[model samples]
Target: MPTTASMTRRLAIALTSVVAIFWFVALGLGVYVMQDEFTEIFDSGVQETAERLLIIVANNEARDASGRPVEAAVLAPALNSQYLTYQVRDSNGMVLYADGAQEPFAVPLSAGFSQTATHRIYTAATTDGTLFVQVADALDHRSEALMEGGTALLLPLLLLIPGSIAAIIFVVRGTLSPVAQLRDEIHTKDGGNLAPIDESALPKELRAIARSVNSLLARLKSALEAEREFTSNSAHELRTPIAGALAQTQRLLSEVPPAFHQRTAQIERALLHLGRLAEKLLQMSRAEAGIGISDERADLLPVLMVVVQDLERSPLGASRLNVKVEDGTALERSVRADAFAIVLRNLIENALIHSPPQSPVDVHIDINGIRVTNDSALIEPDVLVNLTKRFTRGPTEASGSGLGLAIVKRLVEQMHGQLLIASPARGMTQGFEVEIRL
Candidate 1:
């Protein structure tokens, strides 16, 4: 099965990703700006050092014993490490003096600033242009500075990414909690539960949805109630007249001559069939009215036994039915006694009526559920699947209103139980079975 994506998860991920992307972009921009500023400051320092060394070397050049100028060198040693290294070169690009530099810089003697593969060099000249002072700063030093600065900015982000993700997920889930609640409320609505959703706790964005759902539920409830009422009233009104007509036809059969007896008997059988149909309609109406659920729990074993006994009183049911209740089992449930009775009657009656003559109908009750099986040829899969529909029957000539399984299925669903129908009943080669799980 394909999995559904959750709104909360999607929202959280989208928000977190956007936040992370923006943070990284901003960090990159910040590092770029910082590197530029650092370069400017280091270049100014190199230029200033070169200009000062030019003036100092011109005024304080070392003199030989004959009072002629010679090479001059200025060296400053500090306790801490030095960041700038420099060497002074004359106009011919000859090394005149050195400080912390190991060798002459790889550049022509020129004024202003220049760069090599390893260093940033600023060359300054005298008024006479006879000498030049070139100061060098190592490229690795600036790179180290930029790396440290970038690390400082990135460390906080490492901690922030996880925290932001958690915070985003938390907020998204909290914001969507009302939607989850609304979904649960809508899911609970069915034939048995059509109650309106509570809108007081919903956010403004979802309040309209709740109100619309409530309106729809109200309409459905009213329609179902009206339908049930009509069915119940019609069935109730027809019962007496049907019974009276049946009784009168039987009387006429006895009083009429032998030639007319067949017609009267046909009329009586028709009335009986009509009466049974009316009764089934009544049961269907009751089932639709959600009569299966109850707050009070009861021991349903006795109810099952009563229905079986009642069915067995008929000649057709005599010695053809068998029931087995597992040892240490209790049929305690929250279903109403009358509703359970109706379900049992319909199931057992369906089995008895549809199975082959003299074939045993078996009823088994266990801790898990109830099973009713009857010996018969395997019903087609297509027909079996629809056997629970109203007026749909298997390929049998047995007389049935076809509402028995339909009624059973409705009540079972209202009771929040499962009803499964199978051909070639469990452990049998050719039979039909209905199992109810509550």
Candidate 2:
């Protein structure tokens, strides 16, 4: 398949070819028109020369072959135009009298003072009924004149064709310069770069093409990033399980008493890690698939309260995490969101996992949004940026599959809400916060 750039260039060239072909045909027609004009001039001049010769022959009192009178001149200056070469012919095809030449030219049959030769020939009867003819070399003159005229006509065209082609090349290349720039940018794109190309001021013909190419680049960039994250997450999440399985196998082989007991425990723990990995993979797939989450008018305060209550029922609930609910001074308490239960469950679960043990996880909820900030050191700045990225985990202080916050972010976005996290004093006090729209 032809690439977009190559296809566009070929189209441009084809258009130019069409124009050049029409122009060439037009030039040829012009040459033909000029040839006709030359022929007309030649014919008219020959006829006039023959007519003058007829008058000259009729006026003369000279006698011809049988005592009939015939007129003859030694090529008068007025008739010595060279193109109008004249000859006097008898009734037979014989050149009896000739001018402007020592030898006779072709004396074709000229009857009743009419044209016969390619050059115009006039024949007339003298007073004695003797035959006389006057003719000129009009065809020779027309041929020479046309050839001379064409040097001016065809020569310029010879130069024009190449110059026109050169101009088209320059114009097309200049017009497509933006596309060239876009191609170069695409060639140099990194897996993470998905930014759109700036194609403002491009001609309308190419604007659509540029937009389509940019869109394709954006999709490819997204796919590559998703693949990288998926691979990284798989390797990172499986590490623990693989290690546990290996340790159990070693213990079963080395230890003598109660080996089966410890081995079973290790295998169970490894199975648990595998189960979490499977869930995380499923969630990642859902996020990547862009499944539309149904929207509903959800009350922020009650939904968050239920989420906090559920988390309190979990192991972290025994740790006594502080969950607070705040509200905005707005008339509307309800906003469109995905399933309230799923949203709250992901947020609360993420908070419990990230918050330090014995440190209170503050689940601050409000009408506009909810902020789940916990007492913990913030992860590195880059890590915080990558928090919403699939398979990214929080600081090593917390044991997590790293997909909890990413799932929360995806869920919130699906609900048309935003998620933001910040930790001031390097996660010392203020901790990380996730603010979602109501």
Candidate 3:
């Protein structure tokens, strides 16, 4: 994409070129108009000079004894700018008087404004025989004067064109600086920060744009606040009843007979599933509120230990968990502590409930990320595609709330991380794996 500065400069140059071309065309038209007027004025001067000389030669007082006038001399001037030379001829084609040695035309031309190869001839009759006064002006002389006039008209514009382009560039750059600053400020904002953009110092055109952005930010903040409040209130409200039901079920388990024991245990599992679902709803609210978007980072080892201990106290503790971290790696590395702890608990708990008793779920922390693999999970490929979606559970018979991986995915995104799930996990012959990259 073209940038602001480059586009501005290109437009300036195009306009300048157009203006320059227009001026050049105007100058050419001016020169063409002057060309006809110049020829008329020069030819008039030649005719006037010829008429005066012809009168002098044709006057009766100037006639000599044989009715032929005596010859007279006309000298060439020193300046020689548009030098004019003339010759007079009698009726019988005899030269009466002449100035300069060369003749303008070899054969006699007719009367009144005759043009030869190089001269303008005037043939007149004045109470005697015919007389020709021919005056010739050099063609090169008129051409040189016209060239000098055209040069004087066009010289100054050469120096001004570059400076005009430079001024346009400087002005355009200054004009767009505010827009660039506004874009940078808006680009840095995320779900964690929805503050209004500054508009006090902006140009009038951009002030409206900033105002619109601030209005949008206001609406988004309100919506997120409402969502967080409802989730928190709902979690708190549901926890009370679900806890009461679980407590009643545990107490009833001791008093029940062997046949009733199985049914009571099923009731207890349903209550626990309801409790976990309520907890996951609260976690979703935290993710939306940017609680996991902290800059301070902590180690992964402590959070992993806590999550593993949490699973050990659950019904799925019958299975073994094997954790392996490469030496000198993943121990000192910083992780998003509170957010990742929740993610770890959800992942390991899901693996624990799905796996058979005495089977091991392996968790290995590497330099780049952490991977959890469970060989006991055997799900279809089509179902694996939607496993990260909300309210999705494994195919196993063990009861689940189905919000574990959903909450984990939401929190990971809040922390600017990635959660990838696959059945028949990478580098494994057969298993399910969840890879969390932060």
Q: Name the top lDDT candidate.
A: 1
Task: List, residue by residue over 138-196, the lDDT tens digit for candidate 3.
Answer: 66666766787677667756865786688777887788899888989788566656778
- By summed lDDT, which 10 consecutive residues of candidate 1 come out lowest? 72-81
Q: How close to the true structure is residue 84 of candidate 1, measured as C-alpha lDDT? A: 72
- Of candidate 2, the 10-residue stretch with the lowest lDDT total is 329-338
Estimate the TM-score for candidate 1. 0.77
Model 1, 287-387: lDDT tens digits are 97887876568899999999999989997798888999999999888778888999999999889989988789999999877999999888989888899
> After superposition, which runs of candidate 2 have C-alpha atoms over 4 Å from their true positions?
1-20, 62-75, 89-96, 100-120, 124-131, 201-204, 210-229, 246-438
TM-score of each: 0.77, 0.47, 0.63
Higher lDDT: candidate 2 or 3? Answer: 3
RMSD of each: 4.4, 13.4, 7.0
Each model's C-alpha lDDT? Answer: 0.85, 0.62, 0.73
